[model samples]
Target: MSEDVLVVHGGTPLRGEIQVRGAKNLVSKAMVAAVLGETASTLYDVPAIRDVEIVTGLLEAHGVKVSTGPEGELVMDPANVTRAAVDEINVHAGSSRIPILFCGPLLHRLGHAFIPDLGGCKIGDRPIDFHIQALREFGAVVDKRPDGLHLSAPNGLRGIKYELEYPSVGSTEQVLLTAVLADGVTELRNAAVEPEIVDLICVLQKMGAIIKVHTDRVIEIQGVAKLSGYSHRPIPDRIEAASWGAAALATHGEIFVRGAKQADMMTFLNVYRSVGGAFSVDDSPIGGGIRFWHPGGELQPVALETDVHPGLMTDWQQPLVVALTQARGLSIVHETVYERRFGYTTELRQMGANIQLYSECLGGTPCRWGRRNFLHSAVIAGPSKLHAADLQIPDLRAGFSHLIAALAAEGTSRVYGVDRYISRGYEDFDGKLAALGARTERP
Candidate 1:
């Protein structure tokens, strides 16, 4: 099935309520936190993805008893966890950045651990250097092995103040997980405070971890001898909700993203409105939802830039850029996050969109992706008639953007890699398409 390409029929209006499952970002961290607890942690609405399976298998390898009920409820008991075998290490090799997080809990619980090489969205060289550095601050000695990473803390862990160079999500999570059971308070500065991280912190707090968040990008974690189990309802996936909203705009359809939080999506919502899109949001006390639609007016092209949380998410840039194809004028987008993200535009060009890559910053803070293969820029000339063909998904977000483009195209599109990982976040995608009046079938 990995080799099979998903064929999509274009020019279908996707309408329906797609219920997002537990976030891919949250579920993995929640799994890791379960190990920190003394009792069983049962998580509901967990998304069934390869990463989830990898984490689950890793937990089971450590002698943690994990089982799932019929409705995808996951029960994890970590009382018996001792050591993770090499066979378990093989399960998550090249799977996700998450396996590296087990280092903290494994070291605390068993005093020795081995973490396989990490894998995730291949945006760039996401080395675990920051994660290693942070863990070392907490009194861990790590050795790089040919097969995997071997870590030990025979003297036990004593927390210290640590700062991150870049707010790498995996590294930040490693700090949080490792700090929970350390000897003293650990302060993390310049942390990646993405909503997912906050959600993970909430889960830890629920488990009796003493953690405090200050406005100056500082998180203080006081070490505790033990943590009790927690049952948490994770925050909705903002990225997935943004993709659905972008799909509505690109396809010229209306969609109400149920369970979407407007608080986390303010930047995206602002950008969408700037593009002559109209959306009415229903804000809840805790987690709000949004209803997005393309306004029946002249679509305006606006300059776009990607940033961390609170700024434009780099992940949403691809799909939202597809909607620019229907706008009347040229749209400028600065991708400050990932360098290779612009590669998807070449694929869009094959389908008749006028886009040019620029080498210079085009006038902004040139991002990490700048200076490498026409980074820091893309000029999209829109209102082009999209003709579908064979499309391939290079990564997760790009895959969904490709799916949106295929859906808005004039003919049919054979999108390879839909089976690769699309189901990880999108639930009942085919059925949702069916509800949206799209003529699509699994070939």
Candidate 2:
């Protein structure tokens, strides 16, 4: 586990049970929500991913006391909230983009906030212009500095009616975190309505915030005078569940992912079934999860598109592509979410999968990247015999896809930089791989 290189013996179908905790996307935001509260907040079923660690560090630097309780519960006391030094914040945040989220809460708590140079997965250019404009609209003075961004609310934050050009989740989150404490009513048009955003609204409600979700991607938030803390359990990690399901398909194995709720994965489940994979949902009182397997038949190729929530997730596309490589015919994937998401296909092709990337939109409606010349479309022609090859970990989801390909391939494969990228999202991935009977060694 100490070594960065993982030597994986291939052609073994992974079979076993692995447990998932809270949604990595939601839990971190909930932790950030704690900063807006005057009292302490408690979050349950939190994951052990590096993003959580980064958020915890950022909170602690701002004088929030974060402590762990029994069974993955986190207790965060914002009683002594204070601004942290820029260098210290930069050092602790590493490459995570979570620190940018602190701008809203910190502006309310201490009238000023500083964000270091932000970094995240290299999938695409995730510009923070939307966030800056949203904050500016709320009456915060934003100044760009050499190191990072400095934001100050001299006249205090006042809510304003705003509309997003595109329904970006990060922009929605910024508005939510800021609007909860601003003056007057904040109306956001074309807001992101993802389940995680809904769950975050639930968290805000528990803190005495008044928010309303209207139809047609409109959300209205009425600002309040003061807020208290909240105690809540976060939603389960749907992305992790889908990743495990894809692993089962690629390796021709069976995996029972405990804590994978079917309600959160309906879209992914539909796609998994359409690909000729077999799965059954179990909702017993003694903990429930989904079991996925290959079903010992020719896998069906599919024409897929990545979109916002309620559509196929961009994060789920990569691992499914690995499984699609084993399908009997041609498979098409149109990535409408992130333009550079198909970059991982090159590594998959190196492992003997017939994957071709193109700039033109394929198999779905034209999107933002349609005429941008980004290689966002992929055509994977398969039942291509996979062979092990040395692979470098790219981003989080793509890294997991490479891991699945290595496990499904013949001979041994060496995976490097996993500890840096994959560990950012997946919790104890090596331990889970071992539990699932993957023959792996750190060297």
Candidate 3:
């Protein structure tokens, strides 16, 4: 695919409803789960993202019959999984972090697997150490080859107790996939408790897997001899919802986000309200959703921080920073989860935001990663003028932030790399922009 660009005319109030599709996180995992079943599994409401395509390519390489349904749904049959070719792995290796999720099912069915390097956000050094170690705990012998990682479970997987030092989503997903088919029960402590994990667990349970979630960040999985194909809709993308909410706040506009769940966005909604953003939820609407708006009031600046699940997500930091730029006073943002998250703020700086990076937190809250010599703090002195300029999107949330910058800017702005992968999560983002009255067109 060639690089695509977005030309956006600025200073327009976004006013309309945008429907969010299936969660990108869930659909990818559902594709991974399809690898375990012999029959065809159909996944509906799947977004056409590059990462999703990459995962589908990986599945096809592993000898699965993958096809698109008439309704834009995804169909997968893993009956001939033994036809997995190592050379075909190159096409999808290093495409996404999701490909590594195949380790568990592949090991269970074939007893050996080869995983290429993983690719995703570049916010920090997202090492797969936790994943490798967790797989080892499940009796998988892992070896780092010059090409990629080689894994084998000669004796078959046996349940073992493993505790993670940090609750990483990818690491937690690796453990869950590997543990489900072990010979005995496997217990994972300090597991990531994100909504995506919850969805994955539910999908696994639908396939006859025995899994239980506890309040203490623990997950117990009982080894199942086999799992059937599943068909389910994944959770709505909360991160995407937060991005649209940030766009509404930054432009001081009103927008209704359909399919945005209140339960999934509790942390972001609370922060939105704290920042003087107004929102209302329709519990019994035709389908149920929420509307977020600025309501022509003074936006409040907040001292915020990012954390793992149940905390301010690091992915939301970049887009929310755009809203913080429109706040009345100083807004201090501490990015504790990813050290390099503040890199996108540099782009926002060029758009006329008064944001300064700091090596330490001004507040007394000592962050575990911040104290270790990372430039983990940002101070936004806002109510500043933003001007449109040529911008390039480096990542997902940063892409949304640039979009907000374009909307808040005074003139036309050109954004490159937009078509690279933005639709993976946004789902007809350009159409949403048009509905909102933003002069958005592709070039």
lDDT (0 to 1) per candidate? 0.82, 0.93, 0.84
Candidate 2, poorest ten consecutive residues by summed lDDT:
86-95
* Cα distance off (Å), candidate 1, residue 289: 3.2
User: What's model 3's lDDT at 422?
Assistant: 80
The digit string of per-residue lDDT tens for model 3 on 1-443 reads 23488998999878788877678887888889888776778888787677678888888888888999764588899988864666788677655777678888899988988887777767788887777888887888998888888999988999988888888888888888888778899888999998999998988888778999988899999988888888887887888888888888888798898888899899999999999999999776456788999888788889987888898888888888999888999999988777777888888899899999888875557776656777789999978899998888887778888999999899999988787658645677777898888888876
Q: When superposed on Cα atoms, how far off is each prediction in RMSD? A: 2.0, 1.1, 1.7
TM-score of each: 0.95, 0.99, 0.96
Q: Compose the digit string of candidate 1's lDDT tens values, residues 308-379.
A: 777798888988889988899999988776666777777788888888888666545766655566465888
Candidate 2 colliding pairs, count: 0
Worst 10 residues of 3 by lDDT: 362-371
> How high a TM-score does candidate 1 get?
0.95
Number of the top lDDT candidate: 2
| C-alpha-based local distance difference test score of model 1 | 0.82
